[model samples]
Target: MVLAAEESQNEEPGPAAPVTMFGPDFPFPYDDWLRHPAGLGTIPSRWHGTEVAVVGGGIAGMVAAYELLRLGLRPVLYEAEEIGGRMRSVPFAEHPDVLAEMGAMRFPLAATTLFHYIDTVGLRTRHFPNPLDPHTSSTVIDLEGERYRARTPDELPNVFAEVADAWDKTLQEGAALSTMTQAIAHRDVPTIKSIWNQLVPRLDDQSFYGFLAASPAFTSFRHREIFGQIGFGTGGWDTDFPNSVLEILRIVYTEADADQRLIVGGSNQLPRGIWSHEPADSAHWPAGTSLAGLHGGRPRGAVTELRRTPEGIAVTDADGTRRTYPCVVFTGQHRLLLSTVRCDQSLLPRPHWTALERTHYMSSSKLFVLTDRPFWLDTDPETGEQVMGMTLTDRLPRGVYVFDDGPDRPGLMCLSYTWNDDSQKIAALDPEERLEVLLSALEDIYPSVDIRSHVIAGPVVTTWENEPRFMGAFRANLPGHYRYQRRLFTHFMQRDLPAEQRGLFLAGDDISWTGGFAEGAVTTALNAVWGVVRHLGGACHPDNPGPGDRYDELAPLELPEG
Candidate 1:
């Protein structure tokens, strides 16, 4: 799991990275690609009128379709549910100005690709109130019936500082996190691969729990437990202890959980904005054409089946309209492709099939509430301390984020953001029940504040675990799944695939080296674009290299055989 916590135990190593978000490995500069003077490598004029099927209206799908349209191909996008997919944002009916980021709430500065899209869409962002971030006036760490208000690291108990120190030491000594991060920052692929290859052999099979146990920094079980319950960056990672260490390393290395920010209004503005923005230059369509216009202002229905024809690929929508396209880019959850959509087995090879089956998705649940005002900002009369701030606890509601809109305007609060078992447990309960449980837990932490009294709007709850559209929130690799991951991540470069599987390409966060991140989804979508362009006999501009153009240099470090 990219972000989850669990009790420290005797877990062995698995194919996971040290707990960090993995950055992009492509040779193409994203800013340049976004502009690309040539616009995603000019496809032959012959393919301009050709129609391409883009399944899924999520970020990956929308990005892919936008690029394809610019390249001159007609991309008909299909969606099972809403656009923006997991990056959903909904405003309270009573308070339209206030928003509840139901899906992906925070994004890191390191995610250049995601930011590029954000910038292109002209979306504004503000510093997210992560625990202990300066944006947060205070932080409450409540665990084991003990409560501590922390404004700075120094204010916390010696053990909390020790936990921080231990994590730093472990990342440096055990995972070579410093070295890898430097390579990534410098875009030095060779150095990264060289350093990563050595670690993969030793750590590929290791579990995150094993990494903590083996680290001298976490010698004491109590320290490990503390680290698990109250983790650095994105809350406790105990739920991720059973996941592969590689997954954790990628997240930590990329600083995925640090320097985070939230879209000023809502993250959904990004996708919605892009859907309406006109590319400076485009193909068969006019330069001013928007994706919404191309689909007549509405996306096609969900895809029901995908099969191959003698010509290209055949896709059937829910309405039973069968369209054949020379190329198809699938940017949805792979599990849905296999179960929800009836895909022909011949479309993918056996190895790719197995990888999809093995891909693990972590469950997540989020509940948001809009209050009359930033009541949490009000100082307690007796202690002169803020009632609440960003909170991290081991109780029912693990993480709470206070959204201070203004002094008088309504404020928003992420009452609960949980993962794994906690998320699943909440899914069983209805929204009202979940709200009750969340308030009860918060009352225990802030007994003086009548949190319920200030609530003017409802507690909107979202459970991504059991959602049929998306079975789980994001992708996570289990222990010993490095080989499976390698295949999935590399699938975008179809040159290695058999002829039958050449046209149908998979692109999603699940197919990326780093899952649970929009950066991964964007990069993978671009990778599929490169593959699709090549499939249609299109060549990338010599000056602007695509992912496949630099595949040899940018490929991930291979996991050595056992």
Candidate 2:
């Protein structure tokens, strides 16, 4: 427990340029593309108001819709539930300002593309209270009937330091973390490709746990276990142990898990903001045009069926309304195609179907409760420490984060955030039952404190696996699934595919190389936007080429079929 490591504070700063989610795969500069003065591209006047069906109102769908609107096309969005999708923020009925973020609670500074939209929406962010984060007041690590507190990694015990050193050594010697990090920071394409292409084939079949076991630095079983329980930067990665090692490399290389910040209101604000935002520079539309105005008020209901017709792709909503469009961009969970939506077999190639079927997803669950005040900040006379700090434990609660919105406002607490087996274990419990179980665990950790007394509003719980519209929290590719990931990610480049598959496109974090991050959702959405523009005979500005424009030189490496 408490195995997380902080980045070496002594390491000299390198280049002034920051590391971004540019990609070890595609390496497209989405942030720069968005920032370009030339703008995304335009279509012919004849197709200016052409309707395009966009399934799923999540960040991916919202980005696609917003960019398409800028390109002078109309995007008809459909969602089963709320607009934010997995970036859900549940507010108490009485205190609307007091919110509990059930998903996507933290966002890293490296997600520049996502930040583009955040800044566009004029939202503010503060440093998130992750374990050992500098902004955090304190951190408590409870492991197997033992408890320890620390404000910094150096304050932790010797074994924790050893575990941290072992992890750093493992990444350096085994994964070339520094080389990739430098390559990414400087946007050194050739160097990135050279290192990544070599590693793809060599490590695609390796699991995260397998990679750790094989590492000379992580030879100790105890060290590996501790590292798995509490990973560096973020929380425990044991749930990701079965995923491909390459997944882990992508995050560390770009520092995607480091220096995270939470949006002032909530992460949901980004999607919701885009929904109502009117782009001042958009084409074809007059000033004050917004996605909200286009749809009248809200998006259409969920899509129940999809089929190719003589005219184009046909979409049937849950309300029995049907519409046909020349192209459709699907940003929902890929597995939805096989279950919730009655999709035509010809919509995708057989190999792509296989990829969809083989895709793996990780289950996630969270429980949040509102507190009367920031009681956790109160000092305990006995220990002279904050009553409760950000916590990481081996107990059922797993991890607990405290969010204080000034002493005058109600505080929100995520009592438990668990993934995979841990998530499934408590999936059957009701919200109150879940709260009780978590409170019991916390009581054992802080016997002197009375957490139940501070509770003001609900214990909202979400088991993403149980949500019909979203089968899982996010995709996590298993060992040897690199081929599947490549196929799905590259589907946007449809020239090689048959005519039928060309019109239907995929865009989501699940379809991205680095799944589970908002950056992936934004980048893949841009890819789909490019794909849509191309499908309608539009082209990006020569000065500002899109991802597909550079597909030849910067495409992800392909493994041998055999």
Model 2 spans with C-alpha error above 4 angstroms: 1-14
What C-alpha lDDT values do all the predictions have?
A: 0.84, 0.90
- Give the least accurate 10-residue stretch of model 1, judged by summed lDDT: 1-10
Best by lDDT: 2
Clashes of each: 36, 0
Compose the digit string of candidate 1's lDDT tens values, residues 1-562. 1111132131433344332233433334555566667667877888886889999988899999988988888889999888889899988999887889988889998788888889888888999988888677999999998998988778999999999999999888887776677556655555566666666667778999999999888898999999998898867999899999888988887789888999998888887887888987786887689899888998999999999889889999999999999999999988997799999999988888988998899999999989988989888889888878889999989999888867978889899999999898789999999999999999999888899999988888888878898999999988888888888878878886778888998998999878888888888898888888898889888878777887787676666555
lDDT minimum window of 10 residues, candidate 2: 1-10
Query: Per-residue error at 323 for model 2, in Å?
Result: 0.8
Model 1, residue 311: C-alpha shift (Å) = 1.9
Q: Per-prediction TM-score, please?
A: 0.94, 0.97
